[model samples]
Target chain A: MKVRHSRILRTAGDMLLPLLLLFSLFLLLRGHDLPGGGFIAGLVASAALALYIFSRDMRSARQVLGTDPRSLLGVGLIIAILSGVPGLLAGDAFLTSEWYTVPLPGGREFTLGTPIIFDIGVYLVVIGAVMTIVLSLAEAEERPWKR
Target chain B: MSLAVILPILIPLSAGALSLALWRSHLAQRLLGVFGTGALLLAALWLLQRVWLDGIQVMYMGNWPAPFGIVLVADLLGAIMVLLAAITAFAVALYSLATLGAEHERFGYYPLLHMLLAGVCGAFLTGDIFNLYVWFEVMLVASFALLILGGERAQMEGAIKYVTLNLISSALFLSAIGLLYGLTGTLNMADLALKLQDTGEAEGLVTTIGLMFMIAFGIKAAAFPLFFWLPASYHTPPVAVSALFAGLLTKVGVYALFRVFTLIFTQDTAFTHELLLWLAAFTMLSGVLGAAAQFEFRRILSFHIVSQIGYMLLGLALYTPLALVGGVFYLMHHIIVKANLFLISGLVYRLRGSFQLKELGGLYRERPGLALLFLIPALSLAGLPPLSGFFAKFILVRAGLEAERYGVVAVALLVSLLTLYSMVKIWNEVFWKAAPEQGAAAVAPTNNALLYAPAIVLAALTVAIGIGAEPVYRLAEQAAAQLLDPQAYIAAVLGEAS
Candidate 1:
């Protein structure tokens, strides 16, 4: 019974983080048109991940993240760069964003496009960068030398 | 040919990765240094040629167009900085070969050094403000690692201070970028420049954004009150690493300040310009006075670095063509000379095993060549005649006089004399005094060619720049002109959209 109870709490913790991360993404994506965007969202997601790492072991969390934070940083940078390319393709100049419409299964086509992608790129960058610093610092602190 | 623009950043980044992955082998690390520095040098020289012969070079990665794509720019200013970075990186790499031992090499030093170089190059070439922030973080992370590479007590203490201060600066930088993006609705520097031009000089959101950006850059450049973190942290690292950090890192901040202030925030001259002038004067006086009070060789040199930064800031604060050119020239001279001096200190430490001036004396009688090596750069740093440092100061002081800013000129002259006094103090203490018996015995006369080679090469370049002042001065003048103009930069990036 105790094992099941602890298991339930573990699953609750795990589930809570991704949900919060998604909510942060929502805030980041809607930021330009609304209140939040890439940076704050990224920070939120990173904070959630930090909680997960604290509750769980770092090694397992690393497995879930699937790469070193440094590589994630590079990938984020590349995506950010790629997001800016569409505006360049339209000859709008570097990092220029353009809006477009994509059809959904419903009767209406929704407004979708590059600025959001750029935000997502920024999201990845901030999350990756902040995590890299935090994780390194945590690891450094964990060493026996501190005692 | 646009590939020329990306190569400088890419080569070092790849080499850095390779070094980290192959950390078990010292041979691989050494090879990484050779190939990385070589490729960077070749690329910088090629880019310089292209900039000189064919005008500004802009590369949009993966065939993207401007204003929408991330752009790598190689105008005269960017290209010259790239070249300067390449020169210092190469020399520092050579110096590190002798200064760093196997244990230090095993601690991921080479990889971090290359990443730091990549960050510096990327910061120099990037045309987007957000991209510049990313690169700044890259440089900062690598610097943090390098600072604490040995994990000694002193290293940890310094690293904590360095990381905290830089993290605050980075946060400010990010917040500024967010504010600017919110206000202007674009992150591209070129796009913002065009947008700002149409927006005209105003006292509202633009000024607020401008102030934020200036504070961010000012902190990074270690200007005035923002400079306290530098002297506290700089003396903790190994000499070669500190030399490279001293030479390139803050200059990257100054470079960003120069780029953004010239292109986007030109309208707010009254606020930014006057603030920079006062800050420059304070930074100069405080830095030199701090140096005058230091008894250690490295600590004194570190303080002098702050003081010299004032001259560079003075150029920008004055904001005339001559003054800007002087600022640019001063940056070039300061990087080479400052790096060389730090490397010489490394040599001194190697010979005497102590950096404190009071601990030992009388090196001139023992090692005349090293003494001369130290003397030349020290003199140049003091703004003595017929050296690159003098010409840089002359241009700045002349511009101050021409503008009839008599007070600034007077301060500049006073700072120069103090700089001379500080340099002479180092000379008198380290080279001229009689060798203490224990100190002289500790100094074994061993010739390490790799270490001295970089210093000698840097000193020779100092003379070369001094002799070939006409062309170099003209290059700086062109760069300064382009900075003041902004239309060309905006048009180049924005193209026909405007």
Candidate 2:
């Protein structure tokens, strides 16, 4: 679909981008304990980016991304692999989840672990892979000969 | 020890990611390509040694127990296949340095190749059936990308067919996994083998699921009736890519067949294995006959891949220790020889500038070394003596006789003769005949070590396997014994809980 520029959409997309990204982060953080996870959160974030592309132009959307989607993929995968290494270092199998307890205010405790890091990695990978495909397909559509 | 189990998968995967991260640097990507595959070869060698000395190696992902979490198991067969994949990947990575266009390299060839290697290794190492399906998709995606990397018209056409058929196969595989899980409540293969043994009332459902896996894996293996996609697409890629696919891809499918039939689907050998036997015979006959008609260098080699797959399945079909040994031996032998053949075909294209036998001639007169390199694989592929293929065929044929499967044995010999005919045709057209009079001034052969080194090493490996067949045969024999008796595998995966 050729999305013609609409001022209202452009304005709304600019306003909604931050909200959507925050919500995605919420989903990623809640992934280990709840139904939300890296995959869904990444999809939601990419969907927000797709909206931004439809309202603005490809150049602006890419400017906002600020780096190649391919690099995001590489970084995400490396992060994921690194997260798995702690398991190996702990004398366990690869990808074994290790937990750490943090002291919170009022004598409370918060649990943290490698799974979150792994989830963040997956989050980046999903977004990067999806955007790479979508951006390329959009660019392909923009060719003058394609018309 | 558990860490060692995953190194083969992890190394290539990280290398792929690293190569992608260094996208702007060609020097880095090239270095990553060689170093990554070389590291994988070393890791595979170490894993094979560990598995040989220590027996089956099993590691549960995330420290989950067997039947509940994903498990990586490196039996001897799995280790052997991993080593073969590393061998092929390393060789092709070297070959690609010479032949791959700069455009393709810039467009992420090395990264994709490494990912493909990771996928192949994962498929070899994973012990869970669902995980196996995931690995297959990993392979399919990377291969599909590699196949159409250049985005040529013919490649697009080939990729469509390849993807469509393979996607169907994957669907079948997933559905079968679903049905098997529904019936038995487990996706762990070792656990499934145990659960399946007790599913007395659900025998028919189990067998149905088994057939589903067979058809699914059969398409991937390029078995009879579902093999059209292989020849349609295998030749469209660059020669290094083709060599990699020829050596590794379909063999993974064959490895899956060996794993499933020998481990999980052994309950009704009369029904399932019997079907495999007939299908294997037909796969052999049809693939050889198909090669007899093709004159294109890669196309001919592609068909031979299908035919060779038949011999492997025949070993599985006969379902005896010796036959399984032969099958394992053939897997090693064929990966080396077939890949070398495709690599040699690339060298031929470089020298003569065509894949069509009709357009090519007189390589023997100009570059006799190339002729000799081609002959080693071509003759061995036809199952000529004192080469790896000869020993492989000898064992399989003997196994067929001992099992009293005379009809398939006869077909096997007949197909061997026909394979020789096709090889001779290539020899005559590409090497023996006078260069078509137009290019009377022979093209000066470019001396590129990257091109010939891989083929020479692989050819030497083939000869070594033949001359030192005893040790290799013993390895296969032990792998076959492990395959025949699932107790060790089960114990290794499930620990004392089983």
What is the docking quality class of candidate 1? incorrect
Worst 10 residues of 1 chain A by lDDT: A1-10
Superposed Cα deviation of residue B2, candidate 2 (Å): 2.0
How good is the docking of model 2, by CAPRI class? medium
Q: List candidate 2 stretches off by more than 4 Å.
A: A1-3, A104-109, A144-147, B439-445, B496-498
List model 2 lDDT by residue over B1-498, tens digit each. Answer: 466789999999999999877878888999999999999999999999999999999888988878899999999999999999999999999999888878898678998999999999999999999999999998999999999877777888999999999999999999999988888889999999988877788888888999999999999999999999999999998889999999999999999999999999988999999999999999999999999999999999999999999999999999998899999999999999999999998888888778888889988998899899999888888999889899999999999999999999999999999999999999999999998866423243578888799999999999899889999999999999999989888889987334
Q: Which regions of candidate 1 fall more than 4 Å away from where they truly are?
A: A1-143, B200-202, B440-445, B496-498
How do the residues A4-105 of candidate 2 rate in per-residue lDDT, one tens digit apiece? 788999999999998999999999999988999888999999999999999898888888888888888888888889889889999988999999999999
lDDT of the candidates, in the order given: 0.84, 0.92
Q: Which candidate number would show the highest DockQ if scored against the true structure?
A: 2
Looking at model 1 chain B, report the run of 10 residues with the lowest lDDT sum. B437-446
TM-score of each prediction: 0.82, 0.97
